[model samples]
Target: MKMSQTQAPFARLLDAPVTLGDERGRIRILYEQGNVVLKRSSSVQGVFRGLHRQAAPSLQEKIIRVLSGRIYDFVTDPDDSDGVIWYREITPETDWVHINARYAHGFYALTDVEFEYFCDGRYDEAAEESYNVADTLRDALNLGAIQLSAKDSAGIPMSRPVRRAGDN
Candidate 1:
C-alpha cells in the first residue's frame, strides 16, 4: 500500500502492505491500490501484522554539528593523495589531545588514511551526504553553537554558546 505524505517518512516501506491485528486476534492486511500476492510464511506475516506505525525522530545533523566543534578539521593533502591533515585551533591550550589520537599515534597519517577511505566510499553513500554533513559541521563551528528547537526538562528552550574545556 502507498502511504500518504502526511504519514511518517517511510518511503522505502511504502510498498509494503498495511496490516492490522490484535494481541489475540488473526492479522488482517487491508488491501490498497495494489495486486500483491501474500505467499510468505505465517511467521513473517505475523511480524508485519503486529507492526505499529510510529514516527521516527532524526537528530543526526544536530549531533554531528555538536561533535564537529569538539574536534579538528580534516582535509586531503593536495601534494599527496594518500595524505591528510587534521589540525585544530593552534592555541596554547587544547593541543595534542586529539579525540582519536589514542588509536593512532600520528594524527597526520590517520587523517590521510581516512580521507582515502572516504574517497573509496567505504562509508555510506558519502559522495553527497558527506559534503552536506561537512557543511553543517562548518556552519555549527562558525556559529559557535548548534541551533536547534529542542526544549529542556522544564520546557525551556536552550540557546547557549558552546564552550570547550579551559575556555574563557
Candidate 2:
C-alpha cells in the first residue's frame, strides 16, 4: 500500500526482501538504473496442466493487490499458454512490490491437476475457493498479520529498504 521511488544498487535492493521478512516467500527483486521491482512469485507456480481443489490467485489480482491504491484495468497475456490475466495499474511510482498470492498459496494448497483444470476453464467452483484462500493469505502477509520471522513476534513492519554494505 506504500509507494516510493528510489535510486540504489542491486545487491542493496536484494537485502531488502530478506530484511522485510520474505525469506519463505521466495521473493525475487529486479532492478534497473532507475527503478526497483520486488517480485514474490516463483516461475514454477505459473504453469498449469491440470486442476485440483486448490487454485492460485489469478495473475491480475496479484498486481492489483500488491500495487494498491492505483487504478488497474484488465489485460491479458495472449502469448501465455493459459492466456494469463494481467492488470495495468496506472501509477507513477517507480518502486513496486509484486506478490503472486495465488502462486504462493497454490504452491502449498493446490495440486497440478487442479491447476490445469482451472486453466482449462472447467472448474469455476474450485477456482473461486482457491482464490479466496489465496486472497486471505496475501492479505495477511501484506498486512503483517503473518510473521515471517520468529525473532520478530510483531511481524515485519513496512519500512524503507535499509542500506547495506556495497550500497551507494
Candidate 3:
C-alpha cells in the first residue's frame, strides 16, 4: 500500500531488503583512516524512517546537501575502482557495529559513513520515501539541529545526532 506524505517514515523491520543493485556506487566520505564501508541492512530503514517522524517540506534536499560535502568519492570512480572503489553491496564480514550518535542510534560502518536498509526488496517503495528522510538528514547535519512543529514531532524522538562514524 502507498503511504501518505503525512505518514511516518519506513518501518524498523527485522528482515529489511537491501542491496547495491546492479549499478555501481561510491562511498563519498573519509572519516578515520582510508576507505570506510557501511553495511545497509539497517541504515536505510533508520535514516529514511527517522525522517518521516517530522513534518518538513525540504527534507530530501537537506540530506543531499549534508551528504554532498562529506561524500568524497564514489564506488564507480577509476583509481579506487581497480582496488576497491565500488559502492555495491557485498556480504557483511560481521554483524553491524552500533554507533551511538547523540540522535538516532543504529548500526554503522566502521571505516565508512554509509549503511544499508534491508527493506524486503521493496526499494522502489523505499526510494519514493527517501526524499523526506534524506532531507531530514541534511537538516540534521547542516542546521546541527532540526526544529519540527509539535504536530510534526508526533512519533519522532528527541535524539541529538543519529549515527557517528569512527568516533571513539
Candidate 4:
C-alpha cells in the first residue's frame, strides 16, 4: 500500500484496502494489529472535534477511518517551529489517516458522519490536552459556525504554553 504524506511531518494518508467478493457481499480488513483500543464516534454536520492529544507517558498513535459521510481532518505538531497544520477532506472512499502520538488531531464534520479509530495506547483522561480549534485553525480554513463540546470549547489557545507531564 502506498502512503501519502500530508503537510504535517508526523502524519500520513493511507489507502484503505479494496474489498473482495461479489454482489452477495463484500469484506475488507480495516486493521490487523493487537494490543490497541478501537473506538467509534458519530457526529452531525457542523460539529468540530479536537486538536487533542494524550500527553507524554500516555501518548497515543491513532489510525482513523471514515465509515460514512465526510470530514475535514487536520493534524499539527505544537512543538514544530514551522507551525504547519496539515488538512485533508476525507470520505469513505478508501482513505485512512495515520497520526503520530506527538501531533494533535481534529476534524470538522462536513456531513453527518461515523468514524472508527485504532489507538495504540489506552486513554488517560488526566493526560488529555487540547488546543482551541477556532483559535488555531479557524483562519486557515473556512469553517463557520461550528458546534463544540463543552470541553473542546474550553481548550487552551495555541499561543498558550502546553503543560508537559512534569510541569509543576
Pairs of colliding residues, candidate 1: 84-112
Which candidate ranks first by lDDT, i.e. highest?
Answer: 4
lDDT of 4 by residue, 1-168 (tens): 346799999998866744443322233434433556666677788778888999999999999989999988877788786666667778898466789999998888888887778889776899998888565455556567787777788987764322212211
Candidate 3 lDDT, 1-168, residue by residue in tens: 222343446642223223332112222221111222223322221222232211122112111112211221111111122332111122234242222111122111212234442111111223222112233344444423333323334532332233323312
Ranking by TM-score: 4, 3, 2, 1
Give residue 24's error in model 2 in angstroms. 2.8
lDDT (Cα atoms) of all candidates against the true structure: 0.23, 0.26, 0.25, 0.73
- Comparison by TM-score, 2 against 3, better one: 3
Against the hidden true structure, what lDDT does model 3 obtain? 0.25
Which regions of candidate 1 are displaced past 4 Å? 1-4, 7-64, 67-69, 78-86, 89-168
TM for candidate 3 is 0.20
Tell me the tens digit of each residue's lDDT in model 1 across 1-168: 455564556543434544443331222233333323221111111111100011112101100011111323232222233433333332223333322211111111111111100011111222111111222233445534221111111221212222233332
Candidate 4 has an lDDT of 0.73
User: How well does candidate 4 match the true structure, expressed as C-alpha RMSD?
Assistant: 13.3
